[model samples]
Target: MNARKVLLAEFLGTLLLLAIVVGSGIMGERLANGNAAIALLANAAATAGGLYVLIVLFGPISGAHFNPAVTLAMKLRGEALPASLAAMVCVQVAGAVLGVLLAHAMFDIALWQPGDHVRTGVAQWLSEGVATFGLLLTIVLGIRFRERAVPALVASYIFAAYWFTASTSFANPAVTLARSLTQTFAGIRPIDAPAFIAAQLVGAALAVLAARALLPAHSSVRR
Candidate 1:
């Protein structure tokens, strides 16, 4: 694949992903009439649906890895070159920021504001670790056994993770960073992002280790 095309695909995919996440959260909060559960449900549903479509659309181009953790996993697995990994991570972050700004524009909010939503503590960090672990595991296993279902698997997992995790499962590092720019329903405080990102990276690494043990490179499972 051409490097430029790969980068473009990643950029667009990540941009749209953040847009869906932040936009839906904003919309959901506004329309839910102060019902946090309903707002969350709407946010999760929109994010899941958008994620599925983005993956299906961009998977062929760049594997639709909108998340830096997913890109890191691919790099470690030798599925992605180091150069591409670096470029993808950079663009994914840039795109995520742009996506957040886009969402703010749509909602007529301040384009550059620090998020004040205070999310922290050991439980939240653990939840982030677990959420990211499950995400990477799902991607790796889904690709090994059911390549065509990767998008659906990821989307469904995220939707469920949103509800199950205390931090709302901000499994992507790019997303965690971008979300700190907003103060909406999906935003996380800037101070809280680093721990979440560290936990996510640890989780991703552990998932890769587990996947390697469960599914060796030489073992070929019938697809």
Candidate 2:
């Protein structure tokens, strides 16, 4: 595929993904009558469904990697060029910010508010690391063993991660950053995003190493 087309796919995919995440959080919170559990359930369900569709729609064009961590993993695995990695990450972040703004506009909320949701602590950071590690492991293994099931596998894992992880699994750096701009159910405080991001990167790196060990480059599994 052409580079520009690939970049467009990443941008649009990330945009829609964030829109689904933030918009659902806003709607869920408003409708849940202060029941945080119900709001979180709705948010997780919407995000999982949207993510599956987005991956299926964009996979052929751009590999459907909306996360910077995933892009970095691809680069490490030699599946993406360095320039492509940088471009994809840039577009992903830009698209994520625009998505947050789009969600705010749909709900008639202030467009550029900084998030104040306090999601800091060692436990939350550890949760982020584990969540990201599992996510990357799922992607790598699914692609190698069941390429057609990647979308479903990822969506299901994220849905589960939302409930299991303390930080609700903000495993994507772009998502963590963009979400910090919205003070909603899905948002994380800007002050807390850096640690989450750092943990996520570490988790992704570990996953890559684990995947390589589980299935070396010479493995017979289809790439």
Candidate 3:
């Protein structure tokens, strides 16, 4: 893919993802305040469903890797070029900030910070790892089984992981970092953000190895 095209795809994909995540998070928090479990589920469900559709529509254009993990895996598979990877990551992150900024225009996000502080400590770190693992696993396995159906399968897996996983499935590194920038319902504390991003990268890196060594050979996306 061309640099311009790759950048456009990344920007659009991330924008859509952030909108889905931030919007759903706000609604979930509003409805499930004092109900942490339900709130997380609601948000996770929204993210999964929204991503499923968006990835389907955009995957052909840019692989619909709204998450960095997906891009990393695709790159490792030789489906993605390093320049494109950098372009995608950069544009995606910028798009995330724009999405958040756009969201705050319509919604007073600060008022919705229900918790005195965001979730932190080992729980938060583990949540990042768990979320990233599930997300990367779904992407790798989905491609292994049905290359064309990967986008949809990823979306479905994310939706399911939302309720089943402990961390409510905040799997995207860019999303996590971007979330820290806002004080909204979807926000994570700035101090705690880097570890989560690092965890996601590590999870995705391992998934790449797994996809290479374990999955059946498929040249559809070479590595």
Candidate 3's residue-wise lDDT over 128-196, tens digit each?
777787678777776656777776777787777677665556788888767776776677777777777
User: What total of clashing residue pairs does each candidate reach?
Assistant: 0, 0, 3
**Cα-based TM-score, every candidate:** 0.97, 0.97, 0.86
Q: Write the per-residue lDDT of candidate 1 for residues 1-223, one digit (tens) a residue.
A: 8889889998999999999999999999999999999999999999999999999999998888899999999888878553467899999999999999999999999999989999999999999999999999999999988889999999999999999999999999999999999999999999999999999999999999999999977656536
Candidate 1 residues lying further than 4 Å off, grouped into runs, are none
lDDT for every model?
0.94, 0.94, 0.73
What lDDT score goes with residue 128 in model 1? 100
After the best TM-score superposition of candidate 2, give how far the Cα of residue 194 lies from its true spot, in angstroms.
0.5
Error of 1 at 26 (Å): 0.4
Output the TM-score of candidate 3: 0.86
Model 3 steric clash pairs: 77-222, 77-223, 78-223
Q: What is the alpha-carbon lDDT of model 1 when measured against the actual structure?
A: 0.94
RMSD of each: 1.2, 1.3, 3.3
